[model samples]
Target: MSSENLDVSSELKSDSSFADRTKSVSIAEKTSVIAVEATSTGVEGRSHAAETSTDPLAQPNDELNKCVVVVNKESGTVCDLWDDHFEAELLERLKANGWEPGLKLVKGEEIEETVVAAKSRKIGGLIAGGGDGTTNSIARLMLGSDIPMGILPFGTLNLAARDLGSPLEPLDAVASLYPGRTREIDALELGDRLCLCMAILGVYPELLNKSEEFHGRNWWRKFTKLGSDFFKAFLSSPKMELSLGMDGTKAERVKSRMLIVVPGHFQDDFGIIPKRESLEGGKCTLLVSKHSSAWSLFRMIGNFLLGRSAQDPDLEVKSAATLSINALRRKKVLLAIDGELAKFKVPLKLDLKKRALLVLDPKASEE
Candidate 1:
């Protein structure tokens, strides 16, 4: 049978079981119960339960031994629905599959803590459950380590998960633990800081920096705000002079309204926008758009929606092994990496690390 047909059967069986489990409980209540039960069980009990659960995805495999799951509670509001019952269900699922699930809750500023916990426990694999920012945090901590990482989409954008074709359902995510495929994604290191997703300045970052309450009003409101923000940025025409390097080449000066370096493509309600080439083999992709005019920005948006970025001349795309950025002026620029906002500093260095991360991919062919 074809792979699609096989996957359909498997998906049906999996969905059936999930339905049975949650038939009597609302999604919110079930999640809450799972979290509470799992937490109360403590690490030892939870491990034991995972070892005995009947879920195929949780079944023990040589590849999944000593797996640790690190979660960021603030990743997405939807994750808030994940309570004790949901955790209990997950534990049961893992145990059924003969795997042990080690869960760790993380604080926003406690990236180091999560790393220490994973390392000290000799975890063979790490599961990052959060949004782009949380994924970035876990990836940063696990860099240089041999351990593989799993991406669990629990964010608004979920750019990485969409790119990887990972499972969206909770149990399916746990099942993906067995895929064992790894992709070497590019990362940008600004000075001592690292960014796994795109970094941006100009109108995009400003929209990101807005409070959730303001942007949460409605789709129309968000669109209006974005339009207004773009106009304001265009009127200001604020430009920053940057010294940049591509593929170990000598640094050159470029002035632009926005500079975006992305490790992978990002898709939204609009459509797919192709990103720079793969980051494998220790190379990073840089995209520079100098057009500050309102018309230029509108055309770029149209191009993105139409998936015609390759045909756009104003969009300069380059591949490099490393890039260094320095501000020519004293004024600080707004910076955002992986959707997190910050202030830009001069002399920022970004280099690609080859085969740095081992992430889970469900669509990968089985060995």
Candidate 2:
């Protein structure tokens, strides 16, 4: 049998084991644990303590409204402005709601430290402001924890927040915080690292590297720079040889130009994109692009705009519960998870941590 055929057989066998693991947790136990964690973490019912106390504006109400607002002060455009005014306005809004907002500036290598502080203080919810990178960092911190998360979109292509209908305006989102809604969102775990949106390799990762330079530049300049980078990459994009393992099975090698592993649907101008059908069933979506000409790249983009990229002949799409990627040679490639760029390494493994994140999305009904 061909390697592709063997991979299909292996994938089917893994699905049964995945289902058994999910069925072991009871609904009641899940609910009780989440509630207990929320209350203990400082998010439950202390909205008005600061006002009643003798001290004036005592520590800006850290007790009742436990929040760690993570912002990337270095990101370009409105993110800097957003971070500048975040604390004062956030505290005001939380205070109005009878809660205190804890503000923490995530500076030089302090992401893990801030998360630890929030957990130690038993804060209620985590608010991630800035772009996708900042959001992913905060989400990774709260993974497997019952503490709910809120988004304050301030980055280019606030894809995750756009899906939740929360725009970049801090006070506007804060105003809608009362009677908050929650949704169980999917997460992808690659080795020790957790990704809340997607794990991307190839051309997209390279584009992210270019995008970082345009940060803080004018909007028009940023757009122009991006277009130039895209054209350059499109012209010289090299094919990659990779081996993939699904759900702990043996590996299958394939040659491709790009690979995108997604846990949920990412939004664009093409309307509400649907994620992989088995997303909630403990699986991830893998898209591998075959070697193609410039014209083929244009067609793929056009098809994606028309909401038909999956049907394009040059792309291969599949669903898997767990995936591992290995490069044939040790080449320096770029990798991105939720728009954050990093150096690529060989033997990248992704595991499905199904429905592990509690995201606040008042717009969507609970599943």
> Which candidate comes out best when scored by TM-score?
1
Could you give candidate 1's per-residue lDDT for residues 200-260 as a string of tens digits? 7655676556634221113356456566666676548667688887776888888877778
All candidates' lDDT scores?
Answer: 0.58, 0.58
Pairs that collide in candidate 2 are 41-122, 41-123, 42-122, 43-124, 47-98, 47-99, 65-100, 76-216
Runs with alpha carbons beyond 4 Å of true place in candidate 2: 1-66, 76-87, 96-98, 106-108, 210-212, 216-224, 266-281, 331-333, 362-367
Q: Give a tens-digit lDDT track for model 2, residues 258-281.
A: 888888544334642322333355
lDDT of candidate 2 at residue 279, scale 0 to 100: 32
- Candidate 1 residues lying further than 4 Å off, grouped into runs, are 1-64, 95-98, 179-183, 210-228, 264-281, 365-367
| Candidate 1 weakest ten by summed lDDT | 6-15
Candidate 2 structure lDDT? 0.58
